[model samples]
Target chain A: MNAYIDVSWPSLLIAASLLIANLVLSAVLRLGMGRRLLVAGTRMVVQLVLLGLVLEWVFDSANGPAVLVLGLLMGVVAGVTAVRRTSIRFPAAYLDSVVVIVTTAFLVTGVSVLGILRPTPLWDPQYVIPLLGMLLGNALTGISLGLDRFLTGVLRDRTRVEGFLALGATRWEAARDEVREALRVGLIPTVNSMLVMGIVSLPGMMTGQILAGAAPGDAVRYQIMIVFMIAATVSTATFGVTMLAYGRIFTSDHRLRSAGALGIELD
Target chain B: MAPPVDQAPILTAENIGCRLDNGWIWRELDVNLAAGDRAVLTGPSGTGKSLLLRTLCGLDCPDEGRVHHRGHPVLDQDRPRFRARVMYVQQQPVLIPGTVQENLELPLRFDINAGRITGDGTAAALLSRLGKSVEFLGQRASVLSGGEGQIVGLVRALLLEPEVLLLDEPTAHLDAEATECVEKVVLEWVDAGDRAVLWTSHDQAQVQRVRRGPSIDLGSAS
Candidate 1:
């Protein structure tokens, strides 16, 4: 009785008109993005279609390890994207990024799937994969913002931080302000989104659920949980990445490493 | 008067060299500071006077040589305590965004300086020596003039009762009266017989007034 209407392949082909419209607009405006737009649309279609097939196989097999491996693969991809988002460079950045994203995603998704949602067959591909994707994606954005801000802040306030060091401050004391500011910058986006949730816009997860014929109240509850999970994931990931990255900026002797370490001037 | 030459040097820099992005600032530089000694670091512009002072305070590491505090190499474990005793004041001192008193009290909040907090009258006394009133401590730090900010920085360093003070052009922006006030307070601090001062000043008069001992010319070393 709760079955939902599904779009057939013929109906889906009709959706291609939107991309045609965009391509025509790019042509009329003489925008250089025409080729890029075409490439992007093609890639999206190919990737999503492939993902649909993969998910169908995954859901049918319901293999716990396979689902877990897929989630980790998604995290690694997100982690690489996150590192490219920041201009600052340090030792082991890719490893640090992956550690933060994967750890936070696992923690949040694990808690939601096993403890809160408690779906049958705990590693159920349907529940675990989507939740991990959502958590990892948001965590990547938060951590990249934090890493960029903190590194830039250190470069900007090198003198002030050195002043603290000269005054006998521990390394943590020297960088505490910059770290706090970076974490705040990372959290602000999620905090602002939470503030405007539902009233201004329907979030992706909620809208998806509603389109699948879920009741409005059920969709809203899922949206609320997802937002909280996102906020938690962002906080943890940002903190973890920022703290881990500080080791590369400051030497073991507690002195600020040379500008070469950050590939920028601190003077 | 300089402390007796027999007193052991409180700090020493041997064959020290520092290189910035461009080139070598100085090399094979040697210096010694004994208790109650007044040493002036004189050099031409761009001769690394500030960089040398930073090295002395362990804020920077020398590329080629070692710095010893009381005969022990200043290692990572020793830096916190070493910097506590050897304070370096920048030419343009930085203050946190707060009241003057808050800025002065900032160091005491650190773990190393915990329980070493100055009493109510301590900052007031240091300010009075600089001809600043007790009420001056309440003024916003950001609004203070350059001379006033430098004076607050001096008081903050002085409050810590450091064994050696490495002052890098501390009076570059002060008026004659304020400079004189700073000079007098520094002289009184060195008069304690167990402390040392290494100051850099472009002003010949101020340099002559402060150095009771030999002046180290960094320009020659470069």
Candidate 2:
């Protein structure tokens, strides 16, 4: 038997069994939760297949412009998703927020690929795509949660806000409590996940790297880098969105335009 | 800095029109509450009397017109400044989760006019005026009855020393004795020149009590 077969087949079998068991249990329970699992699996299969084809063609493509176009498209999709997930109206500041988050993610991914890790090909799909994707995913989640929580806090506590306003507090002053509360909630999930990482969970990126034949030390090092990148990107993006969106969402009169009118639909 | 104390027409709403859910509550509502005017806004339910009071204080924006306080337009940036000089008391009182003094001082602490206003004498006097001792300041708001709470809410607004006071159904929640006590305190406070008082009341007795000033019947306007 091949050495690779001994290492890989059992892992592959376990993964297949897990997927099958998840589907079977969901169906037997007749709960909608299992449906989401199946949907996620289908989406993962389709997205990976399409990405595989795209990377195969991109690897051989002669034009540098095609790669640039792909990166821009990815950034645009990420920006739209960030705004959409908050379900709040985009203020002019949101454009700045999107630009900041996407640029930071891109810069981080570029630094990892070009300066530090320096994989075989600078634009190698194996390394570059996943790094950028992870950065975008974390940034999007952080900013959206921050924005939603901030706005919800302000809208729910009208009397408290009015009391502050009537007391000679500026718009920002009245919103100060709500703003802090929102930010704390936004940061909690990320901080908790970071704290429990490696002890309670073997994060996906580390596990995937190990499965792909990377040394355990190398996988852990890459995982640490990813964690740092995610924390930094999330902090920056969430702050940027909160600061920018706060201006548009409230009138200078200190009255909030209804949160519903913002036309944002969060998932 | 605080505004000039003796300015005329401390609050004014010019041709104000407000609509709620496709119904006009009030339209072309004009009012000029000069310093120490001590006016009362009386109307039947659903006449937009409360909306008019809110508009004058810049708490609610009118679709058709503007509100000016002491010559300053109550626009967005100027709102906090304007609100500092005015106080809007709602029909239902909402006391912050704290002791009486904490609830009373809530606005002052958050407002930019903190140093300019005095809460010490006001809290003590207000509690006494509403038939409560100064010791009540240590009591939590959750312990107050409806009559006691409304009186506390009034005292909280009074503590801010707002030049223009907007009261919405202030006495509706009070017993006769508490109502008289609150009315006596408010009227006495507004009696001093340079303070403007405009209030809304469903109780005809309140209208009669402050009957000396011009009464705008919003029900007839509609």
- Best candidate per DockQ, number? 1
Instruction: List model 1 lDDT by residue over B160-201, tens digit each.
Output: 889999998999888899899899999989987688999998
Q: Model 1 chain B — which ten-residue stretch has the worst lDDT?
A: B1-10
Q: Kindly report which residue stretches of model 1 are placed more than 4 angstroms away from their true locations once superposed.
A: A8-50, A53-69, A116-123, A217-221, A265-267, B1-7, B21-23
DockQ of each: 0.58, 0.54
Please, what are the lDDT tens digits per residue for candidate 2 over residues A43-79? 9968877977887787677345666666666766776
Give the per-residue lDDT of model 1 (tens digit) for A1-267: 257898898897679988788889999999978899899889998988998998999999999888988898999999888888987756577899998899888988888887789988999998998888888888888988998899888866788888888888888888998999989998988998898887897798988888898998998988888898999999999999888878878876768876775566444
Off by over 4 Å in 2: A1-14, A60-64, A82-100, A110-126, A259-267, B1-7, B20-24, B74-76, B116-121, B142-148
Deviation from truth (RMSD, Å), model 1 = 3.9
lDDT of 2 by residue, B1-222 (tens): 534644547777678898866788888778878866778887788788876876776666788988877766766767877777788876666677889887776766665665654654867876887889988989998888777777877887777677878888888878889889888888888876578788788877678877556678897888
Interface RMSD of each: 1.1, 2.3
What is the lDDT for B22 in model 1?
84
RMSD of each: 3.9, 4.2
Q: Candidate 1: what's its TM-score on chain B?
A: 0.94
**Given candidate 2, what's the lDDT at residue A162?**
62
